[model samples]
Target: MATDGIEAVFLETHNWGKSARFFQALGFELDFATDHSSGRLRNGQGAYVFIAEVPEDHKPGMQVVLTVPDAEAFRPGPDVEVVTPFEDTHFGTRQATVRDPDGRLWNLQAPAGN
Candidate 1:
């Protein structure tokens, strides 16, 4: 099945408070937060931003999350390259990663029970 649409843009930041405040200053409203470590923010038009503290030993990066009806059913065409296989995440979602021709990463996710 085709992907539904962009789900959320994820940001891995070293300073959660500083990054969150930066977005907030740009007019994004906080939708929810978890322990000041991670949060979901939304713009007036409904676009979402998901920020989380960078994990130890992991380099910070931006990830564009795409939503699909069922992650297991996603089929990358011959031209697309798979970086990671579909798997269940600790956050309770099914997801996979793929790399585009220029080497940019795309994260495909399906909500729990999808």
Candidate 2:
């Protein structure tokens, strides 16, 4: 299925302050932050970044989310790995997880199904 392009990036960090500062230094503006030490940042009209602080034991990583017009209709190439079927997210989107040929996971997101 054709995608609308990248929507946002989900990142895990060890320190919220450091991570936030790093992005801010890169011209990203804070959108909002939560008590759980996570927030969204963006630069102009570009896609935003959601950063979450994780325990030291939890390795830091980033995941890219691709915007799809219809999550249910999104079908990848035959060789693509569908790690998870479309599911409703607490953040208000319908998402599915898929692994690239390199074994990295990418999130496919679309508007919540009516």
Candidate 3:
């Protein structure tokens, strides 16, 4: 499957409200917000940012989300390492995590019903 491009940037924050405000101040308009736990924001054009509260035992970090034509059909080469198998998310997307050779984590995603 070919990658479409970056879908979104996922950020895990301890203080969701504060983090959302920080991004808003930077000119990212609020797209939709969930009860102070998570939300989606977009800048002019097509860039998007997704913020969510960090779960217990999870460290706050930035996750790069790449859009693929089909998440289930994306199979990394033998050199690439799979961190998490693809699974459907509550937000209506199938996602998987993989580690690059440089050890950076990337989230591969495909929109629902695609």
Q: Top lDDT: which candidate number?
A: 2
- lDDT, model 2: 0.91
Off by over 4 Å in 1: 55-59
lDDT of each: 0.87, 0.91, 0.85
Q: Write the per-residue lDDT of candidate 3 for residues 1-114, one digit (tens) a residue.
A: 667888889889988889989999999999999985999999986759999998768889887888888766776788879899788898788888889889888888987765
Cα deviation of 101 in candidate 2 (Å)? 2.0
What is candidate 1's CA lDDT for residue 33? 94
Clashes of each: 0, 0, 0
Per-residue alpha-carbon lDDT of model 1 for 2-114, expressed as tens digits?
88888889999988888889999999999999985999999976549999998668898898898888865777789879898888899899898889899988998887775
How well does each candidate superpose onto the true structure, as a TM-score? 0.84, 0.91, 0.82
Worst 10 residues of 1 by lDDT: 67-76
Output the TM-score of candidate 2.
0.91
Between candidates 1 and 2, name the one with more favorable TM-score.
2
Candidate 2 deviant stretches above 4 angstroms:
none
The collision pairs in model 2 are none
User: What 10-residue stretch in candidate 2 is worst by lDDT?
Assistant: 71-80
